[model samples]
Target: EIYYNDTEAKKYAGNSRIIEIQTAMSERAIELLNLPNHPCYILDIGCGSGLSGEVLSDQGHTWVGVDISASMLGVAVSREVEGDLFNHDMGQGLFFRAGTFDAAISISAVQWLCNQDQAHHNVQRRLRKFFQSLYKCLVRGGKAVIQFYPENGQQMEMISSAAMISGFSGGFVVDYPNSTKAKKYFLCLCAGSAEMNYTVPAAKGLDEK
Candidate 1:
């Protein structure tokens, strides 16, 4: 919350490079969702400045966004984004009704769950609560694609394991794995029964292996 102060929020929302990358990542995350062309209700976790939600709006999907930073949400409100915005700390867990959303997406979020910023912060417990709540909120067969910059393999494993423990079945999809600047990690997840095989998307002209 402190990290994204008013000045920083304005700066972040105004940065062309940040906007471009965020838009690209949001588009990629939506692609991984593989939803029908029809509009669907979606959840945007850690939806800073509503940048990712803008992509959802452009695709004709209705969405609700939650973020921890008030300043960031201020920017979102000022932008008059279509999605409803909530100032929320996700680690406390989502309180949406059961099967409330058709799908979910998080861009450059989730990684914060791994960091223990305070004495009361338990990474494992928080992650478990988050995934469980998210799982319960999404409809059966619903999917979520979370794009994050993992600091290391351990963080990636921790996040994935938490999702599986919450009853989600899916795995990672790395895009542009060979390029340092362009490389991205997406945790593609499916809620409830796995009726379809979860296929990892091939890296764009790069070997993920």
Candidate 2:
């Protein structure tokens, strides 16, 4: 498995190149979420070094982040982010009670669930469990914005289909589809409700409304 231990975690947080990439991705994901103009609790899945949580906190939302790597969590703890941090694997699913959060967000993390990290690692089963937990954790009409890089069409379909089966509405949103380099995919989901229209800034000019 590709472990994010202390040194790796330090580089992830401190390296100039990596920090920019992580911060950019986090900003884009939050932009797509179209959060309401109010305070709420958010869940940051695979939050490494609190980059995404920083964005959420800036918007005045309370958040709790979870990561599988203890070293990553340690780095996040040291960052003094306003959010809480937990060291846990998403594949095993979240342990929070039902309807515990107002929204959830993930960045560059869900793709790892597809890996056969161990002999017993089953991607389909694990993905279902994760989604089920995620769906239950959000209040009715809550949202989840997960940004990921799918290796192929099959992988993309698998992720979206799992979320749908877990009771999430909505699907992938691809920005800058014509631009091969800047293209980004965000899985936008609504819990137990229809997808609402998100006002993409006219300046960004995303093809979708």
Candidate 3:
């Protein structure tokens, strides 16, 4: 909220590099989701300026976007994005009915849960709450693909552990592992036991020159 003020939000929305990177990441996340080509209700966590939600909408999916920054949502509205928007903090937890979403995706979000913004902020507890709510709101076998930038290995481990503890089953997918600039981390999580056999897919361009 504070960091993404009105000016920052507008700049973020207007930046070509940011839009390109965000679009590519969102597309990759959706690919990892592996859902059929049909309309579904989706949740976009930390959907800043609806960049990722726009991708979801492009796939003909109905999506609800939630972000802590009102400024960002304002930008999204000004852009005439199609998804429903909400001004809420994900760390507190998603306040939706059980099995309300068919799938969930986040682009460059979720890692904010690690920041100890206030005196009462507990990183682990907040992560647990967020994942638990996400788990409950998704139908059994539903998946969530969250793309984030972890500051360190420990932060990545903490996030994965919390998701697993909250009953999500899946792991990380690193694209372009060999390229520092192009590398991206996506935590692909399933709400419950999936009918299909699941394995951690290998990283893309892992052996690229």
Candidate 4:
């Protein structure tokens, strides 16, 4: 496993080619967000090295970033995007107050939550917290665009159910076809509204005895 705190992860911060791809995708995603002309509060959940921040800033949105890895956030802060940065784990409830943001985005991060079959159960739990927290933090009619890798339909269905149970409406699911260099990517978008109660499955224990 690549240590997220390692220097190698930080090196990706300065990779122009990678940055270009991220920027392009972010721009397209933001367009789908359909933000108002006035400045809006935007959160980049699991933001790595501020690549999203760059694109959000360029688009004139007020952006903030949160990441679990300090080393990765260090590289993000070094970019000096005009927004706040926090060291945070998305699995935990968001610390912000209700209706704190207009929109939220998470890209290429949710798959990290899936480790094993039991771990996949944990992914559902974490995603429930994530969707609930995002719902609480977004104003009515606000949007959330999340891009994640789904191994198959089962995993994708789990995520979709979590979104609805977490109080989001008008869910949109899109599948990106596999490219020459990479596998397919899945994008899920949902509009936040009232809160709904959800019970996530618990992870199976390792001990057989």
- The TM-score-based order of candidates, best leading, equals 3, 1, 2, 4
lDDT of 3 at 166: 94
Q: How would you encode candidate 3's per-residue C-alpha lDDT over 82-132 as one tens digit per residue?
A: 999999989888999899998999998888888757443487888889999
C-alpha TM-score for every candidate: 0.94, 0.89, 0.95, 0.81
Q: List, residue by residue over 1-209, the lDDT tens digit for candidate 4.
A: 33375577667777898788777667656766767888888999878888877788877788888887888888877777677889887777678889888888877776665543456667788878977888888877777777666777777777778878887764444433433333324344545434532122121222222
Model 3 reaches what TM-score against the true structure?
A: 0.95
Candidate-wise lDDT, in order = 0.90, 0.84, 0.89, 0.70
Q: In model 3, which regions exceed 4 Å deviation?
A: 118-121, 194-197
Candidate that beats the other on lDDT, 1 or 3, i.e. the better one: 1
Report how far off residue 81 is in candidate 2 (Å). Answer: 1.2
Q: Which is the better candidate, 1 or 2, if ranked by TM-score? A: 1
Worst 10 residues of 2 by lDDT: 196-205
**How would the candidate models be sorted by lDDT, starting from the highest?**
1, 3, 2, 4
lDDT of 1 by residue, 12-109 (tens): 99999999999999999999998977899999999999999999999999999999989999999999999998888888899899999999999998
lDDT of 1: 0.90
Stretches of model 4 off by over 4 angstroms after superposition: 1-3, 116-120, 173-188, 192-209
In candidate 3, how many Å is residue 182 off? 0.7
RMSD of 2: 3.2
> How many pairs collide in each candidate, listed in order?
0, 0, 0, 0
